[model samples]
Target: PLAIQQTISVYLIAYAAMSIVHGPLSDAIGRRSVILGGMLVFTLASVGCALATDLPTLLAFRAVQGLSAGAGQIVGRAAIRDLFHGDDAQRLMSQVAMIFGIAPAIAPLVGGWILGWAEWPVIFWFLTAFSGLLLLATWSWFPETHPPDRRVPLAMRSLVRDYVAIFLNPRFQRLAAASSFNFAGMFLYIASAPVLVMQHLHLGERDFGWLFIPTIGGMVVGAYLSGRAAGRMSGDALTRIGFVVGGIGALIHVAYAALADPFAIPWAVLPLFLTGVGVALIFPILTLAILDMYPRQRGSASSLQAFTSLVVAALVSGAMSPWLSHSTLYLALGSASLTLLGWAFWRWERNVCQRLPACPQETTAVEPADPL
Candidate 1:
């Protein structure tokens, strides 16, 4: 999908399409039930993905998988917010981030290994089994975090209104849009890296997994650091630091990509990992930023931010893959370098033009951030 770039649009489509319904549903059903259901569906869909023989079929199944996959990504943080207070929320999110941080780095390598030794079907089988485990974990260990008394009524009209209300908020839009662009930069990497690993660098499927380790490693480091230190620094300051680190990594990646001969493997790949570091730095801050903007509708706020990222990712992946077919450097470097410039613009807006928002209240209700 990343190689040809055509199939990835399907992945993005599935991702984006699912976001619209999942959050509202989570709000209606308890978070525990909604998340678990999604996991089961996600597991079966993973199996379908493993069974897929061609792009179209894989895509078809991915749509189902995408729908199922929305829960964990969407509800995970909301679950945390439901349970904790402000610093506590960041702390829990950080811890969860630390734990969840393992997925991106480990999953690909594990999948690559499974694909190499067995058929791709086995990968889906693993996912199926993994989902079952998640279901069991949720059932046995997790409780109803979102109490029935506190649950919001779900309605089509209300859902639409909720979505509109989010986009309508200027503060929400800025933070959400900024995070979406940042994620698009990272997703551009996800969609393009497979080809960059396999085709450009002459790696096999298993090697592709191994290649993911460094980038994920950077992500883990960034997330851990951000989580630990978020208390000492303003969230805004912390977020900017992430963008700067990420930007530096992106620039280095661009430089290496431009100078490389055929495909040096380590050359641009190292910088690519650095870009991952940048993403790691930015992800939590973006989430928290949007949360501050619209705390009451956290599920909606998270959903919108997630939806935006997935949508932006799909569009970016679809657009850049065709153009950057021959040049991995051009693709990765181009998108990320541009995101860096955007971060600069956003930072200026936050600092100078926009009124700095006050520290967000710890309550779960939707409220203004500080102010702009």
Candidate 2:
């Protein structure tokens, strides 16, 4: 169990560290090159993971895989911001999120099927094939959304300056915190899946679908609703609705955890559905808002936001999951706390925006001051 948790944490740590670089690199070169390069590296790492014979070797390869895996998500976000704006961007983001939500539900089922027939290495082989396919698809279809004219030079000093500027901005901090904590509230459950499924629910490895399917299903529905609500509702209004739904889910989860006698399947997992809906609804809004803050440096903005979330995820997986997995009530309380933190951050951002002479949401880009 410790080894399993470590494996997950190491990947997330490497992923979080590299995320800071992936965004700026994409901003310097082009989204296409960075994504293609990362995919190629990820494919090779998957091969290494398959061949690894020992835990250390597997950890090494997993770290390598993590290093490369973040390029696509971070750079892809920048690409979306580059091509679209306003409601169009929100709709597309929600649509992409809806599709992406399916992966978590599908991966465990696929892995279980593979393990039933073959050994653990075959799973890595499957990942290799999947990443290889993605690489090919990207090479064939992905475009260079960031033109040379808009590209920032790859200078260490300037990169540091830009990072510092984005990180220190009050609005960026609030929005990133909101997004990260919101996701973390649910990710706590995901990271704790083994304990929740096997130990608490008394289910086997194959029964993971009971937990993931409904959660991701709710995410899909929420994403669909967010897409539908794009132009009709304001971002603030949408975000508020998302928080309300998520808060209710957290409270209900806490109530059930405290009251339930056995902690069974359908009932234990139902609140996660609401949490998923809330997360999906708020994610695209906060993401687009951050990207809009730095129009010319969307990649950088995306990277920082991803890094924030990944850091929180790593901590949750490594530390929180281990501590909280022992009790359903503990996990429920942790989730609720995270949700409250996210809502507080969102409220802070709103208050700050109200006080500003120009709303950050309306501003397309705030150009960085020259470090020199």
lDDT of 2 by residue, 136-162 (tens): 999999989999989877677888878
Best by lDDT: 2
Off by over 4 Å in 1: 1-11, 47-60, 97-106, 352-372
Question: lDDT of each model, Cα atoms only?
Answer: 0.68, 0.87
lDDT score for residue 21 of model 1 = 71
lDDT digits (tens) for residues 218-310 of candidate 1: 777777776777567766666677788778777776767777677566665676566666666666665765665655556777788788767
Query: Per-candidate TM vs. native?
Result: 0.86, 0.94
- Clash pairs, candidate 1, are 246-278, 296-365, 296-366, 355-372, 357-370, 357-371, 358-370
Clashes of 2: 0
